[model samples]
Target: MSFILGFAGSNSSTSINYKLVRYTATLIKDPQVRLMDMAHCPFPMYSEDYEKENGFSNSLIEFKNDLQISKGIIISVNEHNGNPSAYFKNLIDWLSRLDRNFIKDKKVLLMATSGGKRGAIGSLEVAEKMLSRFGADITGTFSLPNFFDNFDIDKGILDDELAVEHANALKEFLAKITV
Candidate 1:
């Protein structure tokens, strides 16, 4: 089976985006999913001086390696103040320094979730625009709005209408990549 790497942009222990990604990962049948928790992959804040002095963190190197081996990527971004969360941006900054094309040639399913009605749309857009330039082959994009009302912590999506929408999006994503 093809190996797919999945992660959330947020590092929060109880991130809605993380739950969304994990639930989506379970729907794919052909690919074997390996979920990554950003909280575990700690790296120092990105800075020119820091890079020059300490070099790339081991966490960054390991993350890069994971991307290199994976056939596809699934990321659900979390928005903070209508933008990508600082934790996610920091990882991106460090990864960019290592290789601008770190996500090169991988089919990506870009997603996001939020408690608000917008569903972290801003952060998803930002990730889509930036990662595409770095060689991410975006297969599909999805967002779950009003996460608490539509999703259950253990049972996945709770609302039928929203669940169908998400399932269709995920189906399209898997189809495009697996082909």
Candidate 2:
């Protein structure tokens, strides 16, 4: 595997989901990892009219190119009223327009985290289903709830049990990343 791509659905600079994605990327030892914050990769909201008028933007092309070269991906999504956030949904819309199968055959470790107890599971579930349609081979999932209480800025996951679960999921994700 050349590199693993990691990103969160939320573009917020302070997003807990992005923190979780970064923590997960830290656990991987060998491969070159690119940890991207969605804030820096913004593109216009997708629309047929806009696409017809302007085609793919340079940012969208670069984002798709990153996906093309990645051997695996670690993604954590944010939730909004028990569904994926509109910002992330827009990102999906744009990426799909470029190529529905842009993520084809890529190994994926799906994850979610939030301040709430459900840990953004709603968005996680939705993304799991949606990513498969985009041709991601999802290998494992981990949800860390109550982010404030369960995670530390320097320490990563605080709960020992959840740490084990996260590690196991990451291990599985890494084992099959080259398949």
| Top candidate (TM-score) | 2
Clash totals for all models, in order? 0, 0
In model 1, the runs with Cα more than 4 Å from the true position are none
- What pairs collide in candidate 1? none
Give the per-residue lDDT of model 1 (tens digit) for 28-84. Answer: 877799999876767778999999999987778988989878888999999989889
State the C-alpha lDDT per candidate.
Answer: 0.88, 0.90
Global lDDT for candidate 1?
A: 0.88
Q: Give per-model TM-scores.
A: 0.95, 0.97
lDDT per residue (tens digit) for residues 4-33 in model 2: 999999988888899999888777887978
